[model samples]
Target: AGHSITTIEGLEKDNKLHPVQEAFVKEQAAQCGFCTNGLVMCAVSLLKINPDPDDQEIRDGLQRCLCRCGTQSRAIRAIKRVIG
Candidate 1:
């Protein structure tokens, strides 16, 4: 296994959060936060594939990750913020 992996912790550099993380925080996208890590990871992966995804595409990209805290709307806003 010669694959490189990046976790949530690895997304930070120079004490600065990644754009996605920053957006998430700014939007208060995490309520309970139980699903925050997964949501963040999914968002990162989605953006990697599609840097400028539309609202529906963003929804579709994050659909696989479940957030029981009802923070999906905020998360979408955060992703849109990153896109902008």
Candidate 2:
């Protein structure tokens, strides 16, 4: 029960991927592409607080962000690289 929802199209404009979006593509993550945007947003928030998050920290961060395609593993990898 969140207050707002963000999407991939909303995350980018003028052909520029946000930092998290760039990280997502750079990591070769995202399968169905449904959760890509929200995942990226979550990544952004997480990185804002902890620029260097470990594996478990990432997994814990994304716990509530769900994807129908289940690309969690790939997303985690992307977040890790971006944070690092």
Candidate 3:
């Protein structure tokens, strides 16, 4: 048996943006965009377990991700948008 995997590209469905991806775009969450994929994936995983995490919880969950382009705040906003 094999676990399923979904990359950032895999988030699209039938040529449309997944809600999470739409949220990211609406929030302008990426700067250089280098960390966008990984961050989005992490957010997806976190939201799955905790659909409505608080600000601190969201911060704690994404602490492992790094973005030299300084998009952390917007990334947090993006995740919140999807959760709501």
Candidate 4:
């Protein structure tokens, strides 16, 4: 277990949106919503280590995440939008 972790709820502060959140909203990346949090967390972690990952890299990084809403491609685009 990690001593520190950032949940989806932890991504915002001071009435401002986190970059990832802005990207997601702008890209309309979420659907149904159940998997949004997990996917966001995965993207956050990936960005921390690889700020400019390619699309396939992003997909590989988030392979464990399941988005029943069919927002996988949109979510990956959102992360790219934020990092670029």
Using TM-score, give the best candidate's number: 1
Per-candidate TM vs. native? 0.94, 0.73, 0.90, 0.90
**Candidate 1 lDDT trough over 10 residues, lowest sum:** 61-70
lDDT of residue 4 for candidate 3: 93
The sequence of per-residue lDDT tens digits that candidate 2 reaches over residues 1-84 is 768755657768788987788878887777887777677878877887888888988888888787878788889988877766
lDDT of each model, Cα atoms only?
A: 0.94, 0.79, 0.86, 0.87
Candidate with the greatest lDDT versus the true structure = 1
Instruction: Tell me the deviation in Å of residue 19 in model 4.
Output: 0.5
Worst 10 residues of 2 by lDDT: 2-11
Would you give me the overall lDDT of model 4? 0.87
Pick the winner on TM-score between candidates 1 and 4.
1
Put the candidates in lDDT order, highest first. 1, 4, 3, 2
- In model 3, the runs with Cα more than 4 Å from the true position are none
Candidate 4 TM-score, true structure as reference: 0.90
Candidate 2 — which residues are off by over 4 angstroms? 1-15
Any runs in candidate 1 off by more than 4 Å, and if so which? none
Which lDDT tens digits does candidate 3 get at residues 1-84?
Answer: 699988888888899997777888999987887888888888888888899999998998788887788888998999888877
Clashing pairs in 3: none
